[model samples]
Target chain A: MTLLERDPKSPLTWSGNLPVTSRYTFGLAGEKFFRAIKDEGKIIGSYCKKCDHTYVPASQFCEKCLAEVSDWVDVGTIGELHTFTVLYEGYDGARLVQPEIVAFISLGDGGLIHRLGEINLDEIYFGMPLEAVFLPEGQRQGSILDIRYFKPAG
Target chain B: MTMRKVAVIGAGMTKFVRRAQETPKELSWLATRMALESCELTLDDIEAVCMGTAPDSFDGIHMKGEYLSDGAGAWRKPYMRSYVGGGTGVFVPIQGWYHVASGMFDVVLVVAEEKMSNFYPHAQAAFLTIFDHTTERPLGPNLLWIFALEMNRYMTTYGISKEDIARVSVQHKRNAANHPCALLGDPDITVEDVLNSEVLAYPVQRYDVSPVSDGAVAIVLAAEHVAKRLTDKPVWVEGVGWNLDTAHWTNRDLVYPRYVEYAARMAYDMAGIKEPKKEIHIAEPYDPFDYKALHHLEGLQLAERGQAPQLYIDGTAARDGNMPVCPSGGLLGVGNPIAAAGLMKIAELFWQLRGEAGDRQVPGQPRRGIAQAWGDLMQVGTVVIMGR
Candidate 1:
């Protein structure tokens, strides 16, 4: 019998993760950005004079001007919350004991997306002043986690 | 409306290697800089950007095009990413062609990048997701196994021999010796070496397959008026076409690639060429696998059905011969970084047509060339024809 003429029967099914693992290098700008956070406990941004803009999280080029940005500056720890969301469930839909507040904090011309701490979810509001809290020295790794979380500025 | 003519003004590529120390974004930037520099144009001169990358699985990054936009010099400009498995490389220039032919953009940047090494252990694992979950994934079939089946079918159907196919690998690798960026260019390679190589699957030996690679290629495309100002030796884009068959690869005959023919026909129609074998001066058929080069040549109607092997045997496909195939060393000799490999062919044709390919340039100053790329369960074909 032809493939199209085959009789209908029980359908077949299969499920599995793609048999692949990945190891990504923190890119050129990322390596420098993370190193500064880990070694110096600093927040830095790449400044582009052509566009007169500074990009947080550091970047190799300015998106607006398409020019290489070599001038990196300390963006400082204090920032204003541009947006926030409270998550009560984990990625797999599991309930959390305490809801986590995530927010985008504006720094330089760009911003950072991280978790908010030291403030109740009800008290979290847009444009709220916040400061990054870095992990204790020696406990810091060259990662975004180097900044443990953002909290209300004193 | 009359389609505005488009021309390739400049081309650039990173070395095809087993692994790249640079990130995908950095690789994209390097190629972008080289291409823009080749044309003496900057990002400010580019009006739009077209990016082609295959399988986010290989790079281990989702939305890879968006992540690579800035490096491709897309910053604050109209940008888009196009994909069709391996066909993406060739399709990207086609995408750029329309952007100019449509008159929406006067100058466009086309970039294709692939970093297969990011997939740990073996990049073959990433290809697992490309299979149908219910019908094929359960079979656990890798690309080599399926391609072996196609290779076996082609041989049996045409009464072809292993030695005849091995010659393609030998020829391409030897040709690659002249390519500065080639990863596997072996000048003294022999057909016997291919025949004796380790067999990954029956009939598919180690030498038969293209290496997994990391690389990026970029080209600048401009409308006729802008191309005249950019460079005097602009290679005009004569035609472009692409076609995809059903994902049910099992349902189709494995002996020949019909989709490639359809796509080639579409391109020939647009280019106003009635005889591809006569009109196409240089043919860079995809050679990720040696037999694939021959397979695509037949599909592109450059050779008779099941008779492509004769081209290599008769010296007609040699770099100095009548139709120099894969003088850029092809994916077999250079490296197969998926999407970038496809765009590499476009770059090859651009250099060849402009008589600027250096040591790898073909003789007699060939005026027109055709590049074809095949991918996706062996179901899609992308073809581009360019000429001076």
Candidate 2:
């Protein structure tokens, strides 16, 4: 290995790129979550009454009781602030113009992680409440982003 | 499977560093050489070898095991690589323990190495695939997001204050000061310092996280009879167990690590330990994040659910406390090179059990010890039980 200061000869690095793309089918469980939000304009979850547990975005199987969650329940859009973080950096190693407020919004009996829209950094605490502000049904697609972001609850 | 008894005769490691000029093979060779030197053994004495490493993406190589084999002293010898994320470190010994204990090999060498700094831009950029590619990836998730979410859930469920959790950093970093091999061993680190550090994610701060590092650690293991001949102070591998939860982490309760509990129970049962809190004299739980240490402590049954924070706050989890945690400064104080950090904990335990730890030695003889690591997508839990 030659010094870069002189004439570079180190063979330590190889630069190349691999293009990868694929489509995934979310199967029976995931399709329900997407369809519920897309067609019905509502959030749905798999509620295991035996364990009294409901999962956000739905799961095919119950982890705690090892039972199939066939029963579906419509959960409220309003939820509590489970926990959150203000990310100073992005995944690409760049500083963001807006320090993204990432949070786990407690929805249904279970919860989902989403971006917090309205933020007063000083006032944000662990248990602060929040509500999901959805995009108009016309603009909404069968995707999690269709919910736009969660805002501070009234 | 019934396993024959196995013992650790020696351990060696390269100093944890943010970056290393040495290549991955060179780093592995260095640690392997040091391990052999410590035991006064040659490569010829080894029967087989097992290597532990994280992802190929971090090392910027495909077939990471094949590339790392020679450096691990597996040239023309029986060799294999076992990886289960960060758990790969302790899992190395667990795999090697099986080699010797099963009477398949009289001696086995276990090594773990990671060159996280080798990744371009940032080492974390390579972790993108760990998330659900279609669903979660679309949301722009970083690895820290899972930790923050879990920490948020844990803190909220237990009413645990960030200040109370910050004490793990204080305790571990201070203990790391005594460790010569430690990378960030600053005795002056305080809870105030941790709390005041940059917030990477909610409830997670810069000081609360372990630094990314490049390092390697190796250990020489032998069956009971050979081990007795190799070293008079053989640290016996009493038990080993590992478990992985569902990859879909959102489905599970983040407050309790049932997977870690299951893994610990398996190891403790095999080790004949009914009450780990009373029996485990020292613990070196993985602390990639400071909160993880406390989280794993509760999982290991060293502390009850929601009680680990109080233990740290009450000074009950300090080095001189009734049962010490992370006496080797852990990943928080020592640099975390992923797999290497896990093996470093085992090395520390070997030294502690044999009373060979210089400044980092625990007061009173530490006879029984446990080292655990968690990995995967907020899933896997790996545990090892060892004794003098």
Worst 10 residues of 1 chain B by lDDT: B132-141
All predictions: root-mean-square deviation over Cα? 21.6, 4.0
lDDT of each: 0.86, 0.86
User: Residue B87 CA error for candidate 2 (Å)?
Assistant: 2.0
User: Please, what are the lDDT tens digits per residue for candidate 2 over residues A93-131?
Assistant: 565677888877777766777888877877777668888
Fnat of each prediction, in sequence: 0.00, 0.47
Docking class of 2: acceptable
Best by DockQ: 2
User: DockQ (Cα-based) per candidate?
Assistant: 0.01, 0.34
Off by over 4 Å in 2: A1-23, A46-55, A60-80, A92-94, A107-109, A119-130, A137-141, A152-154
Instruction: Enumerate residue pairs that collide in model 1.
Output: none
Comparing only chain A of model 1 with the true chain A, what is the TM-score? Answer: 0.88
Off by over 4 Å in 1: A1-154
